[model samples]
Target: MSLARFLIVLWVCLVSAALPLNAQQQTEQNQPMQLMDGPMDNMLPIEGQRFRIDADIEEITLLFFREPNSQPLILIKPDGSKWYDSDYPLERVTWYTDPNFDMIKIVDPEPGPWQVAGRVDKQNKAIIVSEVRFEAEPLPKQLFQNERLKVEGTLYNGTTPVSTARFRETVVLDVLFVSSNNPDFDNFGADPTRVAEFSDNGQGHDEQAGDGVFTGRFALDVVPGEYLPTYQLETPLYERSFEDEAVVVEHQPVTIDFQLAEERGADNGIEVSLDEKLVNPSSVAINGSVSYPNGEERRFSVTKIDSFPHVIPLDNLAYGKHLVELTVFATSNQGREFELQFNNLSFISVEPVAEPTAEELAQQARQEAVRKAELERQQREAEEQQLIVNLIIVAAVNVVLIAGAISFVWWRRRSKRLNNDPATAQKNAEKAEQKAQKKAQKKAAKSE
Candidate 1:
């Protein structure tokens, strides 16, 4: 047969043999072993094949199946005593078998292939797997790269493998870039070809399979500069990878592995962040740099402020209330002065180069008051003069009217004499004579 055909045949045989053995072992584990119909002496089934229990009349019997180099199995009694398929290792046998070939013992051991042993009590009532156990170990890390990256690994406990345990893997890249001074660095700075490719292989790593092996990769077009790559593995049962010693990817590929271990202590120092939430005009979230005494630059934020007094609502400030004096203060008080012509409907706070001089401010104030008072006094004096002029005009008009009345009287008498008919003049004289006679009579009575 061809090499491929031969390998296929070998695999099939192994699977078939292993499966039946597992089933039989499981069945024997579920019940007490009993006689199968006929009476038999020292003969029992092992992996569906017959085996002879070496006659140690003490506590247990053993079942052994050999398939190439596989570990020998031993089944034991219901009393919890152990027996080994091979006598070489005395303490290793944990499971027991009965006459009917039922399993009366069970053991929670490390993950791996297990052996079976049997025992006969004085009455042969029960059997158990009491002694040996196996253990499994974690799988090794496998790395692969395609258009993206792929990673694969298994989880095990000692020699046995655990099924269906949740595992998570994460990958992150600290991007690298070439300096402008580099010889190959072109003046045309941003080259799309040199940019890193993108990948979403679940947090920059690989896909996980039902078998607990993770496999996938991230797409990255690494630039012509230094960069770092890291991966984290986590599970409820185990923790691996030291956070401090993160994977460093400078210019080359590095193989990284992780194992579950105990947790490390956390950071102790406080973290300071800078924000620029409150600034003028365009109140926005801005990133600013904080300078240390040595001129080290760090990011920070400066929030917005109220007008006039230039007060900031520092109520929620992390460090509590603080007196932050904004220099060049202006726009308040009697001698108030501002550096710039601000026309905010509300009061605005502007940084001034220097405060207004006291003399200039006082002089301006006095001038304004004086000008207002002079305007009022002028208005009052003008009103009073107008009243006096109106009174004099009234008196002159009265005197002129009285003089005109006298002239009118003289003109009327003369005109009446000239223009009046004789009869009309005689009537007027008669009325006047009557008026005089009445007045003369009153005067004589007063004299008496």
Candidate 2:
């Protein structure tokens, strides 16, 4: 087959194998990755099959598809100078060849018609390099969790905006929040989070389609912490990434406190407080819905705040948990305005206990009086019993004393009668004299 026919068949086969039908439709516009129409039109003139390189282009790369094992490509510059594959290692030129294609890169290329003299397939492309850039607005300094922001960016090719709709379709711009690894922040060691993807499809946050301005709807719903906002632009041929300075996402600026009704059937109140250090109190506006346990919802809005700790009164309070969903719009203390969402705010309401009636109090008093009288009667009976026990003890002691005295007197009289008896006295004296004679006989025997 002819080289062009072979290249066309190969291209079709490669595309068919790589993508499904629906994806092919979506990618048809992007197939000529970074191949601008002006350059392509100027390069492919009617006179001959040659490409052009403009003077302003700092560098250009040419891709030529050829049959496997084909001879190396031959490039003819505008000055009729020829550069061969063997002429590699030359300054400002790089040539690489594979089984299917040859890629040549030239720096400061001559600005005129250039031709490839070889049996190269018709599927060739020229890419302008080192001139494509993505420029974006700097992320705000004071960002809050759950804040939605619209950031705009533009793709530039050598100071010219890449506004072609087909070219825009080939570009993918994404924003990622990579943890700054600052120990002072909450997101330290956290995985990188993709927060937004830029689009030019005139969809959410995008003002218009293919106007060259790419809009990124950033939902800062990540944990309040430090992050390095990184932007990446990717196309089928090349990719570029940029990192902005680190930013800290502050905590939500609105806090809620519920002041439930003091008594049952009374209105409940909610106190909304704003962080004055982060947000302006007067500029804060709250719009929310209260979902009650009984499946009823009430919407409220507070546009004017007369003072701090603004109170919102809630009527027909429910007896169970009530959920509060709020969207706060406020200007930061630095004058940057933003909106925040607080979905999980909630509180509970309870019923109060009732007081007793007058009749119940009177009955309690009567019961106390009867209890006091019974206690007095029981105390008197206990005192009488204790008195009788003490008297019995005293009487028993007296009887024992009287018996002891009578016994002592009778013994004394008996002793006096015995002393007056002479025979008893003489017998006592004779026993004493016998004990003394025995002691004197022992003394005399010790002397002998």
Candidate 3:
């Protein structure tokens, strides 16, 4: 049968068993019998197909597992009366049937041997419920994310533990973390989460099987928030649930901060800080791999730490986005040690702006001097070219003036030679006088 169906059957059985018994019988047994001595002894041994119930039991729940499609089992009461599913007394008897099991709850049941007539499974068990309750330790007021805890609980009938080996086989113990929905907390409006199930099979966190002390290993891996823990114990015939006090699950106690290199050729710094109020700083160790932007990765471990803000230096890291993945092993102030993982931690490294060094400044100064010298040389060459052009102009002017003076002197010497020669001078004067007479003749003709 499914665990859900079993839990339903158990709940119905418990509710039916809780109904009041006969008034006279209740008055006689004013106080319920205290079965607080040892492992549950209320269950009597089965002989053949019959089991006996004691007279002290005001309510009894009997469960029988049958083969598939088998006929409904017939219950033969202590008075030799037969009771079937259709013919049980409505007020005092409740019967439930399924394909694999039949559950019967009897209130103020007759104290005697009852017989079952049908094909019953060999492993069928009879569970008696008397003041059944589930008891567990209250969760701590504060918890940390990724914390693992071992919690123990016990199923009791009055003051005695339910130690039936066969009962454990059919019982289911579960723990659920329900959000407290406090607006002031992080888990407000969060859905309920089933974190762990209790086990008694000597597995994981359980020390022994069928010892009635159920153990559950709870891993607080859910979101850090306020929650109310509920522990439930379920059996084929009854279920008991207990709600623990509210608890706040704080964030992981360790945090990581990356400080990029401030200057060229400087080492990058990773500062790991821990909450001393929650964990012991001296007991913490961090180890992880750093993936640089260039796809190169280096692994490192930090131990023997005795102070807060444990700094780890990463040298020669490239500039760009860098990924840091780490795992922290820390012991809490409460002395509970746990391991936490931090993935997806990353930071960007930018190249630093550095000032020019003295050598670089000197080189710049030398370059400037060379540039100035080149400019001066170009200016000097231009000045020399201008001086040469000025000299050529002066020389050309002086040559022209000297040539004119020579020409004037030659003309004066020629005139003097003409005067020295009479024939030449007389021929020159006659030519001048004949030219003047022709001009006079032309002027007189024009007047006429």
Candidate 4:
């Protein structure tokens, strides 16, 4: 009962772990990409609109949206070259225009200020510049038909995992399988050579979703051959696609012992053995050889062993890397034959160790010193620039303060002159009397 309870608990933990993966996958599939928010960097470049972009971004994706009948988006390169949607070299500059939005994809663009000019009406722009790296883990490359296969993937935006809310909306995952022997297997677009599609969903032989893992099984009844597995993971900030091949073959039921090692100078040998139950000892033979780097080939005599662990003598090898190969042919008592070749096993010869010379050590020290000096120079230059900026700010503030003080003094003197001038005071009194007399005469005329 305790063992059964333990198994039940283990099963429950597995289910619980899988539930979140499924939930996350659903969320990714269902949630609409909130393309307009979260990201603070957006630009609407109009005609003669100049903007500077960071030089570090290796790729730039420009997204433009506007109401219908707005000025068509136009951009001019820094090299005095003009670019509109439909620019040549579909790779460097890609233009996608529809009723929804106008977009462009630029790869390895020159780092500098790029100009934007064109029709501008209620225009919205989004600029996403990032470098993405993808790591794809595929199912076992050697599997028989009907065996379940799994492919897992981890996505990164720049150096960080792509879990940021900023990219969740735009990220998408696609996995495809193609046959390796197709005549036009090199080009998938032209021939549509894909044979199957895998999903992260647990159904259809897949394990779970949203856990950065995708899995799918091939048909049990499918033909045995080499198949290509491909996956594409893309987002607004990042995109990567990879394809590789896997093999399927008939299962073999036999055991072979293979070993290689050197003990001291001449005690080194290669050993291989076939199971007596599956292979008849009289018919089993091993052909082994060693090739050195200098075009010398050393072939061993045919070795036969009815029992396990047959040894082949390997001698007269100089100090270096050597390639060793083994080929085994075994026949059953009933005349069924099996051929197996194991090639390119590298064996390294021992060599005497030597200490670095004093001159070499001195050279290494100089190089390290030069590197440290360069770093110090950069730090000093940065410090000097910061100091210059601070000094300029201080000088500007002083100029402003001095000008303000001079203006205040001038105003105070002007007020004193006006208050102390007797002629000015008399002139003011006479103007008041003249204005009063004119008003009184006008009033009497109106009364009459």
TM-score of 3: 0.51
Show where candidate 2 strays beyond 4 Å: 1-132, 157-159, 236-239, 317-321, 348-448
What are the clash counts of all predictions, listed in order?
Answer: 68, 0, 1, 2
Query: Cα RMSD (Å) between model 1 and the true structure?
Result: 29.6
Write the residue-wise lDDT of candidate 2 on 194-276 in tens digits: 99999889988899987889899888879899999999887655678889998889988877788988776788888888778
Error of 1 at 424 (Å): 7.0
- Rank order by lDDT, top first? 3, 2, 4, 1
- Order of models, best TM-score first: 3, 2, 4, 1
Q: Model 3 over residues 325-366: C-alpha lDDT tens digits?
A: 887888878887777777788989889998999999999999
All models: lDDT?
0.35, 0.79, 0.79, 0.59
Q: Give the per-residue lDDT digits (tens) of candidate 4, residues 225-282.
A: 5556666666543467776665442233233333434444553566655446545787
Identify the runs in model 1 with alpha carbons over 4 angstroms from their true place: 1-357, 365-384, 411-448
Winner on TM-score between 2 and 3 is 3
Task: Identify the leading candidate in terms of lDDT.
Answer: 3
lDDT of 1 by residue, 211-293 (tens): 44434333333343322233333322223331222121122121111121122221111121211121122221222232222
What TM-score does prediction 1 earn? Answer: 0.18
